[model samples]
Target: MHCLEVNDLVHRYRNGDVVLDGVTLRIPAGSIYGFLGPNGAGKTTTLRLILGLIALQHGAISIFGLQLAAHRIDILRRVGSLIESPSLYDHLTATENLALLQAVHRVDEAKIGDVLDLVGLAGTHRKKVGEFSLGMKQRLAIAVALLHEPELLILDEPTNGLDPNGIVEMRALLTRLNRERGLTIVISSHLLAEIERLATHVGIIHRGRVLFEGTLDELQRRRRTHVALATNDDERAIALLARQSIAATIADGRIVMPAMPNTAIAQVNRRLVDAGLDVHELHTAGDDLEAIFMNLVSN
Candidate 1:
């Protein structure tokens, strides 16, 4: 079953500036879904709508077989969200902050220690939130989100502003939460490398529209690799490759063509040698995520 489903969602601000247009997404249960987009691409806006922080302007949002509009409270009861930044009382200790949320969410107070351990903040009960690192603060926020034992967690840019080590910790924590606890997570971020590392499913959004949505393998397959070759006679190499029905181009004084298997590359190399052109260098390139993202958004 889908953990979250968004269909033809459309949204705009009071000034009539459109933010989301016909955006649709489906996240499977127990999978980490990465919502990727540039700033102002409506990722956060969509999250807000899903959380019922703002009214849905158009289209439908369903969570775990329940529609957001009709089952807002029930849906929210099963969801835990940390958007943009974690709201915390800096003056309070980690335990105290969770204690406060436990009262609000009416959760078992005993779960506090368990969650603290779950987020790697154990034994820091007396440390005030103000004294914690940004990464620690983020984990505390996640701890608050988990107090209710919600089935789904939605986080927006959870690694934003975190240092390298902090990013790694956050990544590990999220992975553990999904794999160990069987919780479905939907996280939004513009960081391609982070998404590539952590997400089981990916959705690329650009200018308020979903450009692509699928598994990482599927997205990688959409990216084509190319072969770059340097030779003494670029012109003859191009002609020779064309004679074999291979399209070739000259870029930066090198003969470049779509990537082929090792055998095909060998054939091309042999053909070039037989044609009296000296093959100087040969390498395979392309298949970069950033390049694919740029190409998808630009078009």
Candidate 2:
């Protein structure tokens, strides 16, 4: 079942500039939906409209079968969100800040420790939010957001300023939250690698419009698979593939095919050998998330 739905969502600035135009999405329950787009692409604006922070110019949004605008407070009770940045009191300790939110939301105090541990901040609960590192603070923000254990988790740029370790930890936490707790997550991020690692579904937005929405495999099928093969006879291999009119490029003593089936690589290898070319290595270097993102945005 779809936990969140948006239909023809249209939002514009007061200057009549359309920030979101005819945006629509259906986020399945218990799925990690990656809301991907570059900066100034209206990702945040669409999130705001869904959360009821701004009035929709046209269209409709519903959370868990309830209209977002009409049932604002009640519907929001089941959703937790962290927008562009963390909203926490710098003066308060991590635990204290989370406790304050617990008070406001009427969530149990016992949940504070559980969430802290869940986000891998159990040891830093007493640390002051002001003194924590950017990554640490981001974890605390997620901890606070999860204190109430809402069904849906909304996070924007959750790994904006983290080192490798922090990024891995955040990814693991998100995966666990989704897999173990069965929580639905809607994450907006520019880090394609991070999204690819965590999200089960993807929705690509550009200039306030949703360009693509589907599963990882579905997205991959739309894109071309690239492979790079290295050989001693670079000139011969290039000449051989080019003669067949294969779409290939050369870089660093290797021939690259922008799009070809896996089985075709064998034929190319056979052709190279038949041409008296010495094949050194045949390996597949599939396009990464960045490549996929660029292709979508460019198209």
Candidate 3:
């Protein structure tokens, strides 16, 4: 079952800035779904709409098969989020900061320390949030989100300004949460590399439209690849593959073939060898995540 769903969602500001135009998403349970887009691509706006931070201008949203409008309170109880800059109290210690929210959620007191330890802030017993590093502050905000032990976690730009080590830590934490706790995470980011590293599924948005949505494996499959093959007889190889319904052409004195997975490549190799052709060299490359992302957003 899907953890969250957005259908034909449309949003506009008072000034008529159409931030989202018929945006739709389906995030599966136990998935680290990457909400990817460039800045102003409506990633944040879509997230806010799902969180009910703003009134829905048009379209519908549902979580766990329950319409958000009809079950806002009930649905929200099973969701945790940290959008944009985290709201944190500078004067309060990590424990104290989470305590205030814990009171609002009316959760068990033990949850406070559980989340603190989960976010690696348990050691800072008396240190006020004011003196914490940027990474520490970010972790505290996540702890606040997890206090309720929501089934779904949504984070926007969770690693906006972290150092290399901090970024790695955040990635590991989210992965563990999904793997060990079976948490469904929706993470929005303009950072293609980070999302590529973390997301099992991806939804790419461009100019308020969803250009692509599918599993990471499916996305990779969509990457257009060309195989450059060198054989004893390039001309004969081209003719031979064409007869086998595999289109090929002579490019740069080598046969160029369309995208083929390893199994297909092996089949092609067997076909050529059986045709009395000596295969000498073969190379293939496809668009990476960054390339695919750029192509999607640019178009």
Model 1 misplaced stretches (Cα beyond 4 Å): 232-246, 250-254, 261-263, 275-280, 283-286
Q: What is the lDDT for 266 in model 2?
A: 86
Question: lDDT (0-100) at residue 200 of candidate 2?
Answer: 95
List, residue by residue over 56-175, the lDDT tens digit for candidate 1.
Answer: 889999999998999998888889989998889999999999999888788888998989998889889678999998889898898988989989999999998889998998899899
Candidate 2 local lDDT, residue 97: 90
Q: By TM-score, who's the top model here?
A: 1
**Candidate 2: Cα lDDT at 69:** 80
lDDT of 2 by residue, 145-261 (tens): 888889999898888888999999989999999999899999998878888888999999999899999997788777656688888877667777889888677876678876567
Q: Estimate the lDDT of model 1.
A: 0.90
Clashes of 1: 0
**26, model 2: CA deviation in Å?**
0.6
**Model 2 residue 4 CA deviation in Å:** 0.4
